[model samples]
Target chain A: MRVLGVDPGLTRCGLGVIDAPAARTLTLIDVSVATSSADADAPDRLLAIADAIDAAILKHRPDAVAVERVFAQHNVRTVMGTGQVSGLVMVAARRAGLPVVLYTPSEVKAAVTGSGRADKAQVAYMVAKLLGLDEPPKPADAADALAIAITHALKGGGRTAASGASATPAQQRWVEAERAARRRN
Target chain B: MRVLGVDPGLTRCGLGVIDAPAARTLTLIDVSVATSSADADAPDRLLAIADAIDAAILKHRPDAVAVERVFAQHNVRTVMGTGQVSGLVMVAARRAGLPVVLYTPSEVKAAVTGSGRADKAQVAYMVAKLLGLDEPPKPADAADALAIAITHALKGGGRTAASGASATPAQQRWVEAERAARRRN
Candidate 1:
């Protein structure tokens, strides 16, 4: 089973896909962030986001998606960004007919590093080590995404599921939009 | 110009459209909740949600969009719902290229009833009197949506303006999306 770990973010969404099977090694098939201009229209940028998701789905075809379940309701700006990130990922996962699972940060930490209150660095170190990676993942966000994938995979023993995808029609449509940027280029 | 106002939600989404230049009389186009099995597959349901938004757009080619803005960081569940509702709205607005303006609840109340802190009943009363309707709009949510449309028109002074809708890819995608959804539907 192939699992895609996603760090939902506004500027950069770190993605890491692990192919699970005989070799339990979690390989980093891809890593990058999806960005949109702050001054640009939110809708068109959303389409570009959908396009990126479609491209990722086509490239990996992962069976499931793992997202970090948010526990705290931070400030307004942060919440808005998190919402945007979650929205794009939800739209993309649904479009590709993949299941999505969410894990709380603490749950992920405890599962990965044996500490419910493990910090980001500790969790990242454990994630890379547990996944059998040579070096720690570059970005802290990327490592968190990997842990989300690993936690869900551990919960599923490996599979994609979306017991939590409840987006509106508008969300689906915006996701349908392909990248206008790519066409121009 | 016919303006559609949507209060999007997973269990219940309120929709209202008003014909401008006709004394601003609102035609209670449709009011209902879009529901799916809660325990159903998440991705499939999200796809269905997209279908629902398209249906609304095709049914009512709104010239502009007015939606309620998400304010304050509520509980986790409520916050999550706000994200879902906002995402759906952004998608729907982008698909039609219809300029969208968001109004805080207070603004809507103030515009409709001359008081930002007005209650649902007070706003409803104002809507009924302003439209010269026999009765207040049924389904409080629908009335809220209509109020949002009225607020935008009154505030915009009949011009189509929104925060996002520039020459950037994100803006273009949303503007073109309205056309695309129209053509497809």
Candidate 2:
């Protein structure tokens, strides 16, 4: 299955596509970031990001979309922008008849680095190693996007075991870590 | 000028269109609410709201779009959904080549009624009186949507005096009241 991962943000949104042939096996297809000028009008900025995501969905035709779940507990100003962009991503995925799944940051980190509290550098390193890339994806957002896609792919597409009832040992650990992180927040 | 106002929400989104023939004179063109079930998926809910807003933009062909500005300081759970819907509305307006303006709840209240602190009932009463309707628009969301449209019309479309540099006496008062409300919050 092919998955498109979106690290949604108004200023710089990351888009990454990967082909998951089997469990714990992945191949990178495409990765890029969409950006808009802060000086532009709010509507124009959002439309620009929407156009980028639409173009990617048309180009890649991924089977499902995975987006970073935004929490209001984050930065007050940036969270709104993140939520807005996530909304656009979900709508675009649904319009294309693709399933949309959201993975928390800790879930992504745990899926890739074996630690829910892994720092960005560790997550990026694992993403590079897992995808067999020469180096980590440029910028943190791009790496995060790929991490989200990897999380969805390894978790059985996030549909069959959303409650972690039928998850593997590794997947169950990730779920437990996510719950702990939420409680800490 | 014809203005389409959007009171954005996840479960229920309000849309109102009005024609401003002259300053302080308005006619109600359309008013309705778009609803989605809470049991539905997140993507489905957002797409339903987006489709309704897109249809209204196509059907009404408004010159400008006005939406209630969402504040993150409000309800944590509801604010995210509000921001998401507002993003969709702004994107639709821009896609149709119409200018989009955002008015805070206080600004809408100040424009429709004399005080920024006016309650929902007062704002609805003023919206009905200004539109020459026998009764206020049904549902508080509908009235709030119309009130946003009326605010844009009364404020000269929100393009010329965005900084309040060239605002009229009434608009200047509204701007001051908005600042006071912000400070109080």
Candidate 3:
């Protein structure tokens, strides 16, 4: 299943696309960061990010989108930027008729590194190992985006077997999560 | 000068359009709220807002857009919603090549009510009086939106005389404020 992950930010938004065939095999498809200058006006900067996200969605056409859910309670300025970009990503994915799943940082860490308490370095190492890359992804943001995509592939959501897509551990996890969500609701 | 005002929110985004021929005489062109249901998914709700904003901008063809600048430091969830909608409005306006300005609540109040600490009722009353409306606009959101446009008209920015727009008290105030902002900058 192909999943596009977005680590939303204002100054720099990280995007990573990965193809995870099954439970353990993962292949890196693409990764990049969309940066906006602070000198520019707010509208221009936001439009730049929005356009970049729209272009990525058009180019990748991922089966699903996973965004790191922003907790705006911690920092006001940073959270506003993250929250705005996250909303833009969600809208873009939905416009393409793709399901969007939000994962907390702890969830991504636990899914990738086997522990929610794992440090950033550990998560990055696990991502590199999972993708069978010679070196860890640079700038942490790119790696975090890949980690988020991997988390969704492994423990959150992905394609279904009925939709001409093969089943994997990701589907099973998605089913469980949906059932839990239904129960809580 | 045509002005579009946006009172950004997740549940109900208020939009107001006014034509200030000379700034002091305001004619209400349109006023409405774009609502998103809480029961719907996040992406769908945000898309609804984005589409509504885009439609308003296209239909009104305003020369300027004014949005309430959200301060996310207050309430996390509420601020996130407001900030996201605000960003969407700015992008839509920018896409239409309309200049956008952000005004704080205090600025709006000061511009309309002659006091930064004015209450909502005072602002609403001033909005009605300034627009020559028989009654105060229903739903405080709509009134607040009109106040935002009025603030931009009076204190921040407006179409210049070179654009075939005439002068008024609002333009004089805006010029003074612009000089003050330039000095501070």
| lDDT of candidate 1 at residue A132, scale 0 to 100 | 77
Q: What is the fnat score of candidate 3? A: 0.61
Error of 1 at A171 (Å): 27
Residues B103-163, candidate 1: write the lDDT tens digits. Answer: 7789889988889999999988887776667887878876777787677655542322354
- How far out, in Å, is residue B35 in model 3? 0.8
Model 1 has a DockQ score of: 0.24
Candidate 3: give the clashing pairs.
none
| Model 3 lDDT tens row, B73-166 | 7776578778888888877887787778777788789999999999999999999999999888879989988888877666446434432222
Pairs with steric clashes in candidate 2? none
Supply candidate 2's per-residue lDDT for A93: 88
The list of candidate 3 runs beyond 4 A from truth reads: A156-185, B156-185
Backbone clash total, candidate 2: 0
Candidate 1 lDDT, A70-157, residue by residue in tens:
4336656666656655655766787676766666678788888888999888888877787777777878777877787777656543
Which model, 2 or 3, shows the larger DockQ?
3
Better of 1 and 2 by lDDT: 2
RMSD of 3: 5.9
